[model samples]
Target: MSNEAMQVRALRGRVVTPDHIIDDGAVVLSGSHIAWVGTADQAARAGFGDAVEQAQTAPEGGYLLPGLVDVHCHGGGGESFPNAETAEQAMVSVLEHRRFGTTSLVASCVTAAPDVLRARTRVLAGLCEDGELAGIHFEGPFVSVERCGAQDPTYIIDPDAALTRELIELGGGHVVTMTIAPEKPGITGDDGVNAALIEGGALPSFGHT
Candidate 1:
């Protein structure tokens, strides 16, 4: 094996996996990727003696798990994604979540004017391009006022397929989903919001009642 591949590090903790938890486990890292995972004793037996020797031990009772993915996040750290006008402003929220193990996030926007949506999309798309965001999610502008929840009722309107397409294009292919109301007109049919979202490589998240 190459010297680069031999450079490894390990961490000891209670590792959480999909099937079960390892009470006394070690995760070996080779470069940026996880090279191996098993019990602490197994790490040395599996030809990772050097890694185990240099392993960082987690606090007692601490659990090591995979980073989280938040699909519908507005903001954090006293910053709001919907109102963030600059990339730096938006990054404040991203970093806040990342500090707490949310490595992937989709910035969500509430009901707003078409112009506001356009502007926010532009800013968020830039973050997506830079790999700081996973995708974008629109929570309104085509939802029920009675069930709007936190959505701005003044900006709630009938679904517009054209507008959906426009926002998707603005997202530069990082538009993951848009919240919509099933009862709203232009939500179904061939040329409606649902069709437009699917065609644009996005999904319709039925919400707001």
Candidate 2:
């Protein structure tokens, strides 16, 4: 058997799965993956009674759910991803969110000057390449100013294809997604900014109006 299948660890709690919830459920972890899941009693009766590597149980009234994915998190731990000057500072938010059960996150950047956005994307891209962050998200210079809740309206403008391509190239294949306002002026057709994003393998997600 593979090493992963040979080693077993278990967690018991109020397990929450996609299909249903087990009030007193158990999950068996084999190496890094979940090997089995069911009620606590079922686990005890189903071959897991043998010597296992480790076991954990939740506190009374605690629940066990899958790690969360935050798609648009700007910051945590008093550090802002868009405002971070260095990778270490940016990682502060990454680690902080992970500590709270967010296992997957995208570092989102807000509207900023072209140079500022490029510099920050470089930092976040490095993090993505190093596996510290899932990817980078540009929340825009391509969005509508009237609906840009927290973004700097001063930096907001019509989508520019050249700038779009530049940011993606700088990200080095780690530009997983970006936000844009489809209704924003000059953002449609062949020369549009959204098309540039697609050609660069980044998802042109419509958001922030």
In candidate 1, where is summed lDDT lowest over 10 consecutive residues?
Answer: 1-10
lDDT of 1 at 5: 78
Q: Provide the lowest-lDDT 10-residue window in model 2.
A: 46-55
Q: Write the per-residue lDDT of candidate 1 for residues 25-73, one digit (tens) a residue.
A: 8999997789999998887689997787788988898888998999999
| Model 2, backbone clash pairs (residues 3+ apart or across chains), number | 0
Per-residue lDDT of 122-197 in model 2, one digit per residue for the tens?
8999999998888889999889888898888999988899999999999999887888999976688899988898
| TM-scores of all predicted structures | 0.92, 0.88
Candidate 1: lDDT of 21? 98
TM-score of 1: 0.92
lDDT value for candidate 1?
Answer: 0.93
What is the C-alpha local distance difference test score of each model?
0.93, 0.87
